[model samples]
Target: MDDFLERTRQALAAQPFTQLLGATLERMDGEGVALALPLRDELKQQNGFAHGGVLSYLADNALTIAGAMGLGRAVLTSEFKINYLRPAVGATLVARATVIHAGRRQAVCRCDVFARDGHGEKIVATAQGTIAKVDELPAG
Candidate 1:
């Protein structure tokens, strides 16, 4: 793996929530990032579909990852909005994110969450987010 990709994988390994969700780094490079998650019963809702929170989580993390890659520094999501296009019922889910614009202090990113099943892939949600550089994290 390349330097950035290796570092990114390490960073992801440190995230407890990501581990909890069982998300995998499908792709990470200049083109952008693709995060994949296997759909398990624990991640579904009463309707037996992937919950909106799961989709939002994937979008939020993917946006930050894309932003950090574009900025060449660590970033935190400033804000994000997700629109659910349909119920996600599938064996796997993937969130693909790309940097739309990268500035000195921030980056705008777009992400699409798709669910994959025997039929194929279907976009279940779309999101856009602004990511800001973490110049310095405030002390707790």
Candidate 2:
């Protein structure tokens, strides 16, 4: 289990876009996974708030990671929907993803994105995703 988790983490970290977005895997367990992204100029919209796309991408990635843990294999997102609750104008954002349902070939997960400031945290977005389990292709 430890080996699998380590390999997954390494693979996730190697994603260039994830690195570009400053996304970091904070926690991972049998139930779920958590990810964090710090607010930076590149992530901001013209109005100086975190872009909606950034939140969606973070939530998608978080849920995908969690679903992969549940399936014990690689998975691809079959569908995703996101709701924007409020503008994200904090120093950082945290996405907590939990696997709501798991089956032999499909899994469903939800992610809540929170904007964290010195004062407190606020729900900035929420997302639900369906992922399809896929076998890892043999390496040449």
Best by TM-score: 1
Candidates in order have lDDT scores of 0.92, 0.87
Q: Which residue pairs in model 2 clash with each other?
A: none
Question: Compared to the true structure, candidate 1 yields what TM-score?
Answer: 0.95
Task: Write the residue-wise lDDT of candidate 1 on 37-109 in tens digits.
Answer: 9999999999999989999999999999999888875678999999999999999999999999998999999
* Candidate 2 Cα outliers beyond 4 Å, as residue runs: 137-140
Candidate 2's displacement at residue 113, Å, is 0.5
Q: Pick the candidate with the highest lDDT.
A: 1
TM-score of 2: 0.92
Task: State the lDDT at 111 in candidate 2.
Answer: 96
Task: List clashing residue pairs in candidate 1.
Answer: none
21-66: candidate 2 lDDT, tens digit per residue? 8888888877678888999988999999999999999998988887
